[model samples]
Target chain A: MIKFSDKQLAIPKLMRPVYLVTAGQSKFDRAFPDKRTEELCIDALTQAAEMINVTPAELKSYIHTCYYGHFADHFGDQLLGEAVIHDRLGLDPLGNCGVKTGGATGGTTLWEGVKAVASGYSNCVLSMGWERMDEVPTDEGNFLISCAADKDWESPLGHIYTGYYAVMAQKYWKVFGKEEDSFRRTLAEIAVKHHGYARMNPYAQSPMKITIEDVLNSPVVAYPLRALDCCLMSVGAACAIICDEATAIKLTKNSPHKPLRIWVTAGSHTLRPADRRDMAIPLLPNETADQYKDLGKKFPGGERYPGFTGFLAARMAAYYAYNQVGIKDPTADLDVIELHDAFTISDVQTYEDIGIRPYGYGRDYVESGDCYHMNPKTGKPGKLPSNLSGGLIGCMHSVGATGIMQVFEIACHIWNRWAEIHGDDKLWKKFDRKKPADWTDLQVKGAKRALAISHAGVGSHVTATILMDPDKLIKKDA
Target chain B: MSMFGQVHVKNGQYKIKGDFHELTPNMPIRNSDDGWKLMGVTNPRDMTYIHSYGGESIFFESLSKGKLMATRCDNKKCESKGSIYQPFRIFCPDCLSKMTVIDMTDIAKKTAKIHTFMVCERSGAFNILKRPIKFINIEFDGVCTILMSYLAVGEPEIGMRVVPIFQKLDPTYTILDMAWVPEKTKSNHLPKGFSF
Candidate 1:
């Protein structure tokens, strides 16, 4: 069995406080045939500046260095795309670097930006992420994505990434789900909810008013995972401006947006799922060792910790982020969350990994409707609303930009501009998307704290980004 | 007609011949709805990559000989000494010591069982696997990690016993050269070019 030293398991800490001054995202879609990737990136940066009542040039002045996230150099057919984008943004001669951690590229970019500010190296930093996936057809795109796997071993098997997740789904279905039809329907509910939430976000893609039945009947990509159950292959961009305390206050001087405190922590595992070794379940603050003593007995064949059914990288990321920010219980402490729902099953797996629910009971989080903006069972708000931005499922999996988009989404609610940004008819028309007649304001009222999980390949890399209103600090020192 | 690229290593250098890439003319992509306006051009590229298996070449070569080769950590100082790896590793992960290669054909035949499985209905471009691929993750009694492979016959279920089969004839000298079938599968039912 694998073991960890105290040093390896130590909680991560930043040297100083970092703040998210503002964030923005471009309209997400399957393909942006007319627009170039730089245009989408510029669109995101412009919106970020507008949110803070500043020009793009004004915001650019504050950025000392830049962190660009653009996964799949092969897809764009451009090596050193960051240099191209950096030159286009007119941020010439500044120290800049690119971050590529598969699906977690966006979050990893933010992690670097936050560190740069926290280390006192930069007063302010720009974290930008984008993906150009529409350059190739869907099947070729899938093949390219599969290259992220262990090329020699896993990629050649099917050249399809869905099959990798499908095996995990099959295991979870038998062990935790117990092969019940209701469990399958519960998975479908997540698709319905994310897609339903997409209807409210003007920038979101695949905004279908689909039902659980529609999801269940959708064409199967891999068994137990259908077309609707998968995340969209998208082209778009998202960006965040991270700054130190003084710079943050300076940048948001006249803006309505608040300088929310931000902390980004990351964790990683073996790229190949075959290499996963058994280990002791690292208990979160909300969990006790006694509660899981009977896990194997309760659910047969579920004895293994993080054996295909769980994301240990996500758990470790949350472990460090929670300790850093003093989050005792996510459901009770956090107001909103955006998980990397790369697939419907991965979404449920994340609920368990992040300690929103205990392991083996992730289905309850959805069945109880605690994940909804408004619980279907009750008219009251959910205990902790999740993925009101539609997540990757209904929105975009613009690889490099996905995690940044999630941060932008949660930031919107905390900034109290969700309705203003999402409901504006001008913004809707700007993207050439029709605003739904019944587009409801999904801003969580008085949201104080939020979390976003950005995950990569199987569970290779994951970053947990926590944003809390500075006034509502959970821990005084934090 | 141009021949496909071929490469061989001799004396620490690559000896290459034939065409490595086929160049095609770029075609303009126009929008018919917008008065046939020019939009973009298709850049078609076909290139073959030369990859070296290096230390693990023995594993691939063994597959064509109907042998299953695995690596075991023989480092006595290592914490995970004696742990066998199916997707053969050149060195022990725990101690970073070069491992010893051993044939595990009998062990796989007797102990291999599906740990988890998936049935994929579609595949990405350049995939040669048949439709409705029954992907299986097999675990052996003594193996610390699971091995991912495809089941050549019957539906897959967790805990179902399976045995390895090799593409001994016209082997591609890749991981695809190995597959698994049900424990009781008949020799005649095996896919062509594969043998027990």
Candidate 2:
């Protein structure tokens, strides 16, 4: 069993308010043969500048330091890839550092930038992330990703990271899902919804109009997890500009939108799932101790706190973030969310971990159409629409860039510009993609707050980024 | 003639011999969609990496001898004292003291059962395991941690009884040297070179 002291569980605090002025990303795809990695990064940075109606040079004058997120050096075969990008961006002599925590690199990079501005170290900071997975073949890429696991014990089992992650899915399917056929269909529904959402996203990589049947019929990578249930291996770049209140005002002075208040908190767990010990479930603000007292009786083999089913990192991140931002209930308090849907099953797992739904009932979030941009059942806005950006499932999982892409997506919704950015005909033509005639606008009208979850490894690292309009503060001090 | 890389420690340092890498030529990648224009060059690399087992070498060494080793936290002051770790932790997690290595071969043979399992049909490059690997996480009676290994024979299911099998013949001196089989599996049904 494990325990936490009062100090360890104390809420995290920023010295001062930090705001996200603007964010942007390049078009994501499986491979970019004709373009260099720096070119993709420049595209992302240029978009960030244009979002604020400022020239690239004008934006550079506001940035005092930089944080870069590039997950795999071996994939690109460049050790100092950050230096290369920083040099190419022409931000010379600025103290810049690289942030890498597997898939959570993008969120953790923003976390660093937020701290810099909050601590009065720099007025404005730049946080950028990208990945270059197209450098190697798919099989070789899998082998390299497996190296993230315990090299001596786990990696050699099949030299595949999916095997390590699949064991948890197997357990969750049996314990929480109860191996029910209905639950299996619910998992398939997530794939259909994410892919459907991707159809409207011009920058998204795999915009398939798939169905539940297609997902079920797809080839199985691991039993109970088909190819359609997995995330894409993509190459792209994404970035955000974090600034203090004064700098945020200045950067967005001539722009149409005001800056959104931002807060990023993180948590971690053992890299190997085997190392997770039994413990009591860390209750979110919405949960009570009595709610899970008979979890084992309710669902047999579900007694272990996180044993293969839950992501302690995500739970703890939400724990710190909700308390820090004064979020009493996520489903009612937040307007929109973007979760790291690494797999369809893991997507449901996060709903429970982050308190979107109670443990063992995450399927209801999808079945009830609460996670949709437009509730199919009622044709009304969802109570809390999630992953409108297609998430990692239909969108890109370009490692370091994934979390920033999510932030960019939610910011578009809160800024009430989702349709303008996603439905632009020029962007579609520029990316060589066809705009479906039935393309629907997915903007959440009058959205004021949002959240995004960035995760890494089999729950080794996780970050929670919450963005809210300054006027809609839940707690006056927060 | 070039041979596979070999290394041995001498005078507290690595003494290496033979070839550790191979030279390969780069090839230009041409785009067929645009008049076969040159896009990029493929850099071919083939090399071997040397990894030391360090303090955990005993655990791997014992696998070939048909013994299952685990570490126990014996520090009296530690809150997690008396805990047995199957993955063989070099030190106690709660307290950083070196743990006591204990042979849990009998415990694993008698009380091991599958906690969860997966049947993976795909594998990454350089994988030596057979297709559709039956991956199982086995839990022993007294061990605090579950051990991740592959099933050498039979289908895997949750709560299924299993026993450890070691590659006593031509041991690989790695985690692959050990695998698990369902309880009461006949010796003839075992994979080549593996025995209970």
Residues A369-439, model 1: lDDT tens digits = 89988998998899999999999998889999999999999998898889999999998998888888888
Range of the 10 consecutive residues with the lowest summed lDDT in candidate 2 chain B: B138-147
Tens-place lDDT per residue, model 2, A172-248, is 99999999998988999999999989999999999999889999999988787889989999999999999999999
Error of 2 at A88 (Å): 0.4
The models' CA-based lDDT, in order, is: 0.93, 0.92
- Tell me candidate 1's TM-score on chain B: 0.98
TM-score of chain A of 1: 0.99
| All DockQ scores | 0.82, 0.81
lDDT of 2 by residue, B81-173 (tens): 999998989998888899999999999999999999999999988889998999999989988888999999999999999999999999999
